[model samples]
Target: MYLGVLALTAFVLTVFLLVYLGLFLGRLPFLQLDRTGVVLLGAIALVATEVVPLSGIGEVVHLPTLALLFAFMVISAQLRLGGFYDWVVVWLDRRALAPPVLLGAVIAVAAALSAVFSNDIVCLAMAPVLAQLCRARGYAPLPHLLALACAANLGSALTLIGNPQNMLIGEVLRLDFGDYLRVAALPVLLGLLSTWVIIAGLSRGHWLEASASLLPSALGRAGEVGVPLDRWQTFKGLTVAALLCAAFLWAHWPRDLLALAGAGLLLTSRRLHSRQMLGLVDWQLLVLFVGLFIVNHAMQQTGLPAQAVAVLADEGLDLQEPAPLFAASVLLSNLVSNVPAVMLLLPVAQAPVDGPLLALSSTLAGNLLLISSIANLIVVQAAARQGVVIDWRAHARVGLPVTLVSLVIAAAALLPWRA
Candidate 1:
C-alpha cells in the first residue's frame, strides 16, 4: 500500500512538472501543448501509469467547479452578445476627466464589470477599446492597458461569480452568494484601491505628454463599439443570463441545472449562428478544469494527500487550518497558476478557509507573474494587437508589487475567518 502511494505521488508530481514545462516552454518538440492540453496530457499520464484507476478518478472529479464555470460562461456569453462590455468601455473613454481621475474611472469600471463577467472576456473586449481611446486622446496606451489587466483581476474578487475558480470554490464549498460577498467585499475594495495607487505610481514615470491619432486605420482598431450588435440575439442571451443569476441569488437553485437551462435557452436562437455561440464557450477552460479534476482526484485516492497533510501537521503546518493554507495557497498559486494549484490543494482544505483562502490567494496571486492568469495574458495579447508593448519587465514592474500588497491585504482580512 505504501509503495503504491509513493508511486502514485511520483506520477502526479511528474505530470505536474511536465505540464508546467509545457506551458513555460510552449510545444515540446511538436507535441504543441498549451495549458489545457498540458492538463489533459497529465490526466492521460496518470491513467496510463495505472496509478489512478477509473473509479478513483471519479471520486476526485469536482462537479461544482464545472457547474459554476458553465454558468458564468453562459452569462458572459450573453453579455458579450448584448454589447454590454463594449458599451461600458466607451463610456469610460468618453469621460472628460483628468488623467488621474480617468485612470481611477478605468480601474473602477473594469473591476465592476469583471465582478459579474469573466475577467478574461472583459479584458479581451475592453483592452483594444482602451488602447485606441488612449491613442485618440493623446495618452499612452500602456498605462490604460496595465490598468485594464490589473483592475480586471482585482475586480474579479468582488463576487462569487467573478472568475472560474471563485465560482468553483463557492459552489463546492456551498457558500451563500450574499455571505461570500460580505466576506470578500472588504479585501476586494482594498485590493482595488491598492491597484489604483500602484498603477498611478507606475504610470507617473511612463505617461508621455503626446497625443496620437485616434482615427482607426482599420475597422478592427475601432474595437467592439464599431461592431453591429445583433439586437435579437443579444436579448435572448441576456434574458437567459438574467434569469439564471436571479435563480442563483433568490431561489438558491442547483447551479448546474440553472446554467444548463440558460445555455439551452441560448441554443434555441433562430437568428444567431449556433457555431458563434459555441465558439464563445471557452471549451479549453472547461477541458482544463475536467483534466485537473481527474488528475487531482487520482492523487487523493492514492492516500498521498492524507500522508502529506499528516506530514505538514508534523511540521506544524496544518492546511485544514486557515493560516498555513493561506500561505500555501499564495505560494502554490504563483508557482502553477491559481486554478490548477487550487485543484491540488482543494482536497486538503476543509471549509470556510478553503472557500475564502482559495479565492483570495488565487485571485491576488494572478498579479504576480505575466503568465499567472489568463486574464493578464488576454489583456496583454489584446494590447499587442494595438501596437502597445508590455513585456515581462513592464508587467513585473506593476504585477510583482501589486501582488504583494494585495496578498498582504487579504491576509489581514482573512484572519477573522481562519480556524
Candidate 2:
C-alpha cells in the first residue's frame, strides 16, 4: 500500500514536470500542440492513469475561476463587437500626436482599460487595430503593440478582476476588492510609466519607418473594414461594465455570481445574439484553466508539495515568507505561466501579504519574457496577421528592462505594507 502511494507520487510528479516543460517550450517535442493543448493532454493522462479518478474531476476544478473568466469574456466581447475598441484606436491615431507622445498615450489607454476589463481581451481587441493604424501612417507597429502587451499586464495587477490569475488569487485568498486597488494602484501606475519610457526609448528612431520588413504593396492596407461603432450597443456594454465594477467594489456577494449575472443580462440583448456573446468567450483558455486545475489538484493530493515545502524550509528558503514568496512567484510564473504557478504555490500562501505579493509578482513577471504572458502572445500573433513582425528579441529589448523596473517599484510600494 505504501509503495502504491509512492508510485502514484512519482507518476504525478513526472506528469507535472512534463506538462510544465511543454508549457515553457510552448510545445512538446514530438507533438504539434499549443500551451492549451499540452495541458489538456496532461490532464487526460492523469485521469486515464487513475491518478485522479473521473468522478473527482468536478471537485478539483475551481468553478468560480471558470465563471469569472467566462463572464468577463462575454463582457469584453460585447464591448469589442460594439466597435468600442476600434473607435478608440482610430481616435488615438487621428490625434496627430508626436511619435513619443503617441506611444505614451497608447500605453496609458491600454493599461487603464485592462485594469477595468480583461487584459488578454484588451490586447486581443486592440492589437490588430493599433497595427492597422500604425501601418496606415507609415509607422512601425512593434513598439505600440509591445506597449499594449506590457501595459495590459501591469494594469491587470491593479484589480482582481483584471485578469484570470488575479481573479483566481482574489477568490482563493479572499482579498478585498477595494483594499487591493489601494495597494496596487501606485505600483501599477509606475509600471505603466516605466513601460512607456522603455518602449519609447528603445524604438525611438524606428517609429517613423515603414518598418524594416516592408509589406507586399498589393496587400489591402487601405480599405480593410473596421468594426463599426454602434453607440447604443456600446452604451449597453459600458453600462453593464460600470455596474459590475460598482458591485465588485461595494457588494460583498460572491463576485463570480455577480459577473455571471452580468454576462447573462448582456446575452439577453435584443440585437446581439446570445450565440455571438457566448462565441467570444475564450473556450480554449477556459479549457486550459480547467485542465491545469485538475492536474494540480491531483498533484497536491500526493502530499509532495507540502513535503517539498518542508525540505525547502529546512534550507532557509521558506515559501511562506513574503520575500521568498515573491521571488518564487516570479520564477514559477516565468517557468510555467502565471496561472499554473499561482495554483502550485497557493497552498503556502499564508497571509494577505502573500496574496498581493503573489498577484503582483506573477503579473509583472509576464513582461520579462515573451512566452510568459498570453497577452504578449496575442499581441504578437495579431501583429503578424497584420504583416508586422514582433519577434522575441524586439519584445525583450524593452520587456526585460520594463519588467525589472516595474518589479522594483512594486516591491518598494509593498514594503511599508509588509511592515
Candidate 3:
C-alpha cells in the first residue's frame, strides 16, 4: 500500500510539473499546444492512468466557481455583443481631450468597467477599439493599450466579481462582498492612478506622433470586425449588470445563482441570437479551470502540500501569516499564473486578512509582466492585429514599475487591517 501511494505521488508530481511548465512557458516546448491544451492533456493522462477516478471528477471541480465564471462570461458576452464596449471607446475618442487627459480618461474608464466586469473581457473588447482610435488620432496606441491592460488588472482587484481568480478567492473564503470592497477600494484606486502616471510619463513626447500611414488599413479592418452600438441592447445589458451588482451587495442571494439568472435573462432575447452570445464565451478558459482543479485536487490527495507547508513552517515561514502569504501570493502568481496559484494557496489562507491579501497580491502581481496576465496578452494581441507591436520590453518598461508601486501601495493600505 505504501509503495502504491508512492507511485501515485510520483505520477501526480510529474503531471503537475509538466502542466505548470507549460503554463509558465505559455506552451509545451516544441509542441503546438498552448497552456489550455497542455493542461487538458495532463488531465486526460491522469484520468486515463486512473490516478484520479473518472467518477471523482465531479467531486474535485468547484461547481460554484465554474458556475459563477460561466455566468459572468455570459454577462460579458451580452455586453460585448450589445456594443456597449464600442460605445464607450467611441464616446471617449470623440471627446478631443488633450493627451494626458485622454490617457487619464482611458485609464479611468478601463479601470471602472474592469471593476464590474471581467478584466480579460474588458481588455478584449476595448484594446482593438483603443488601438484604432489612437491610429486615427495620430497618437501612439502602445501607451493607451498598455494602460487599458494594466488598469483593468488593477481595478479588477477591487471587487469579487471583477475577475475569475477574485471570484474563486471570494467563494472559497466566503468573504463578505461589501467588506472586501471596503478593504480593496483604496488600494485599487491608488493603483489606477499610479498606472496612469507611469504610462503618461513614459509616453510624454511621443504620445502625439502621427500614425497616418497605419490608420487607413487598420481602421478599415476595425470597422469590418467592430460591433456597432445598439442602444436598446446596451441599455438592457447595463441594466442587468447594475442589478447584478446590487444583488451582490445588498441581497443575501447566492452570487452564482443570481449571476446565472442574469445570464439567463439576457439569453432570452429576440434580436440577439443565443448562439452569438454563447460564441463570445471563453470556453477554453473554463476548460482550463476544470483541468487545473482536477489536477490540484489529485495532488492534494497525495498529502505533499501539507508536508511542504510543515517544512516551510519549521523554517519560520508560516504561510498563514499575512506577510509570508503576501510574498508567496506574488511569487506563485507570477510563477504559475494567478488562478492556479490561488488554487494552490487556498488551503493555507486561514486568517481574516488572508483573503484580501491573497486577492490583492495575486491580482496586482499580474502587472509584473505582459505574460503574467491574460488581460495583458489580450491587449498585446489586439494591438498586434492593428499593426502596433508591443513586445515584452515595451510592456515590462511600464509593467515592472507599476507592479512594484501598486504592491507597495496595497501593502501600506492593508497594513492596518492585517491580523
Candidate 1 off by > 4 Å? 1-13, 20-30, 48-59, 205-226, 230-232
Give the Å shift of residue 181 in candidate 2. 0.5
Q: What would the TM-score be for candidate 1 when compared with the true structure?
A: 0.89
RMSD per candidate (Å) reads 3.2, 3.0, 2.4
Give the lowest summed-lDDT range of ten residues in model 3: 212-221
- How would the candidate models be sorted by TM-score, starting from the highest? 3, 2, 1
The order of the candidates by lDDT, greatest first, is 3, 2, 1
Tell me which of candidates 1 and 3 scores higher on lDDT.
Answer: 3
Once all C-alphas are superposed, what RMSD does model 2 give against the true structure? 3.0
Total backbone clashes of model 2?
A: 0
Query: Which parts of model 3 have CA positions greater than 4 angstroms off?
Result: 210-225
Q: Pick the candidate with the highest lDDT.
A: 3
For model 2, the stretches where C-alpha displacement exceeds 4 angstroms are 210-225
TM-score of 2: 0.94
Mind giving the per-residue lDDT tens digits that candidate 1 earns over 327-391? 88878777777787777777776766578878888888888888888888888888888888899
Considering only N, C-alpha and C atoms within 3 Å, which residue pairs clash in candidate 2?
A: none
Q: What lDDT does model 3 reach?
A: 0.89
